[model samples]
Target: MLDKVHDLFRLRTSPVIFFVSAGLIAVFVILTLVMPEGMASFWGAGSGWIYDNLGWFYISGLTIFLIFLIIVGFGRFGRIRLGQDDEKPEHSDMSWFGMLFAAGIGTILMFWAVAEPANHFAEPPRGESTGVEARSMEAASEAMGFTLYHFGLHTWTIFALPGLAFAYFIYKRNLPPRVSSIFQPILGDRIHGPIGKSIDIFAIVGTIFGVAVSIGLGTLQIHAGLAQLFGVSDADWNFIIIIAVVTIVATISAVLGVNKGIRRLSNFNIWTAIALLIFVLATGPTVYMLRGTIEWAGVYLSMLPELAFWNDTLADTGWQNGWTIFYWAWTVAWAPFVGIFIARISRGRTIRQFVAGVLGLPTLFTIIWFGIWGSGVFDIEFNGDGGLVDSVLEDGVETALFAFLAEFPLAPVTSAVAIMLVGVFFITSMDSCSLVLDDMCNGYEGKAPLHQRAFWTVAIGTIAALLLTATGEGGLAALQEVALVFGLPFFILGYFIMYNLSRAMREDAGEVGFLRTRRWLQTLPPEEYERRMEEADASLAEAVVAPDYAEGTQPENAPELEHAEQPPVVEEYRVRTGETPIIDPANPGDTGIPPRG
Candidate 1:
């Protein structure tokens, strides 16, 4: 007990950051519990004001990230490796992808997949409400399009830029892999100073809230699943108990280290998610699901540009505020956790491969996932007598998935599977979030102390439970407000990541950097460029030895002399093009020994 206490109190991290983050978290928890209504009102109004005023900024930030990431992936910067020239990926492609999906936004998708699309379907954005009723096919199609927009490439692009920047710097430049390190090119060694500490502190705050959001959602869903499956009560205490159990399990997993605990859980989560998806696709409206998936992909593609730029300012519809803006804020808040964790596991990949995997593969999974659940549920609720939408409208979003599952054959089994998937995703996300927060809290030096990880695991669950209890039914909204408020600075900080990444790429000594215009080319005329190239080539070639002249084959120009009377045969000197002869500046007449002829 004494040793454990000592370990917990050890100052392995920056003191300022550690205390400040802890203090802030404590303050928020206390205030939320003591003044629940006031806390909710403040967070809601504050974040809502930002969303209403700066919706354009959020839209533009996401758009810029997507555009910048695409440019990096396909342009001259594509071929640059994240590590040294010969290094390969730490994890295999399969392992990497599984982990990425598990750690990135797995739990978020679980909560939002069925709920978000259905909510959007009931209240379609940018459409005449009188013309399209809830559960209509038009509402379904429009919902899928917008839902895809919410969880699609824009989010991953935000993740990829920072991942690439940090990976390149950590592996190539040997800098610490922290959020603050992304500014090293602009800030220099001061990255270890006060400014850097402030950046990391911000990241820690964001990560804690970001993780709390997942914990809260997972708790709510798990409680709902229990009620749906076993006829358990959905009391707030039951939810608190669920959060406590998950937090304890997550702490154990985090203690087991990344390879053993986190990686295995991630792999399991992916396969479980896949099984759930397949079961839904096979057992539900298989034909409609397939057809709708095809159509939804096309719709998302066609509507992407307009949707990407839409702020709904003219019509004053609050849909963007509730959905798009909230999602952007959530993703931005979680960017550090996702980005840093990806960088940690992605040592051997090229910039292009990382960008593609981060932006494309997971996105493909997201689209197919929304297709299977969103389209499948829509078919039942609209055409069949399923009442899934009614359940959402009446009960809440947390009950949507379980209610949808209850309609199928073997309803109990499917509901149980959904619960298991959420539980696994919850554990995996917590462990991974702990890893990233640990890395940041410890100055990106090494693995955090075990006790520190445990503290954070507890802190995450505690804060989540406090907020949930404090706000009653408004817990998730309060968490979303927290995400939105913290996300504002990071949205701006993301641009700095892009600029610094490009600058760092330009300075790399590898293939990517080689493609940039040489300084001599930029500063010198064509004649000077040719001259410099010739000089460089000549300097490199000068290491080769000249042909030997044996005693009998001495140069014919050598003076003939008797053996005993011969003046020492003088070595001939010549201007060598291929060899670099060392010249002593102070004693230019002196020559070092050369190779024997």
Candidate 2:
């Protein structure tokens, strides 16, 4: 027991990633502590410069990634599996979707489902119907379309690129599961040196800050829920307590391992969110939402290209920075961490299956969710006497959902459930992010030490709390700006990932074709084919029953057995013919050993 305890706390950590990520966080905290005013000014100016100058880069990079993912998903490479051809997936489809939703977008969906749509409706994007009033039916439809645009296929593609690359390398190539491993084709063994470590460290930094943004948002929303439900004091100490409680819950979940804690919690979160969505759909304008969902989906499809590339350079509304650019940066920032979780759950699935499941299903959920909330809020504001638009205008976006719920029966009960759902989403995200961070730091040498995971959980919670507390008045925005700054490098990295994955997939396809052709040759009709089949059967029987059987050795009943039933043999003719053995097309050097006989 004592030895086990020692092992738990032992230094089985990745030296460079661990220290480098830790040092980055330490420096930020120290800056915040020692020179709070100067740090704020520097971060504010730097983040502003980045947003103002590089918005186009973020837009173009994400657009390219989305297009690449679509091409690859429908192309020949889509049929390839992440693992060996014969291996099966580790989790059920439902469980897989649940976990991905929880880790990748659950909290964001919870936080933004109502607020985003309402905000867009309240202030329609520039150059809409000239006379349409804010929150009008036309404004609501445009708002839902915009929401779908932000949370739709493009966002998932950013995640799918990293997840698919890692899955191919880790499962197909038998490589370590690191962001650097995706660069193996480009850098070769140099991936194991400083270049690789630097890549992983950068990913770690992005994940930490990205997840910190989520945590900060979760805590703020939870405080709002508590203040609304139980009338709790909206004090700074109380906010700190909320972060502490959620962090403790998350740490416990992380320690419980993936299957037991994370999976179960993710399932709970999805079911609860579904129930809430259903309640709104059933109780509100069901027909408008149902019909509106289809209409908005169409609008989203038609307007996708325009919305995807729009930088508002000519309009100068600064709307792109606050909404579109911010959402893109947030998605890119969180992709590495969420992609790790996606790859972890996606063993034994084909590239097409992975892409469809990761990109299609979640985006469907986003559309439905925004459809229900957006349409429902519009119904109340424009058609009914509810003052939701007034509440949003008076208070803030965070209060949109609560204010909408206030018009319903059992407001407190529904609000409480919403809070619980957010809390569980927070927990699942925290645990998954910590697991990903542990893998980034320690590679695939089994799970990182318990203490190492615990350290990350603590660090995440600490940084989130400090960022929130230091800014005080508008801390969430401050944290988001910092997170977006870290996401900048990932835009550049996304291009390399697409190239490397494509290269690997082509290699896999060639090997698969070779084996297929060899099998076809064995099926050709002729006396020669019969002779070859008999020889293959003999070779396989001999190899299996007596591996060291001499070439000419035969049983005394060989002639009689020739007339008996003969099981067709599927010999690996390529290896015997001295041709290169079949390989995972994505991994040429990984020519797996051929079976004897």
State the C-alpha lDDT per candidate.
Answer: 0.74, 0.73
Candidate 2 Cα outliers beyond 4 Å, as residue runs: 1-9, 127-132, 470-478, 511-597
Candidate 1 Cα outliers beyond 4 Å, as residue runs: 1-8, 129-134, 445-447, 470-479, 510-597
For candidate 2, the per-residue lDDT at 336 reads 87
Residue lDDT tens for model 1, 1-597: 433444478745555667788888788777766777676788888897887798889988889888988998888778767765567888988789988977787887888878888888878786764366656777787888888988889878778877888787666555665788788777665566689778988888888888888788788888889987788785778888888888888899888877888888888889888988888889888999999888899989998998889878677877787778877887889888888889888987888898899999988999899988888777877688877787887988888888888877889988888888888888877877887787676654343568877778888888888778757756556666777799888889888988888886665433423332111101111122222233342221212111111123222333332221111121133222222334333543344434335
**Cα RMSDs, all models:** 14.4, 11.9
Candidate that would win on TM-score: 2
Tens-place lDDT per residue, model 2, 228-268, is: 88898877788789889888888888877789889999988
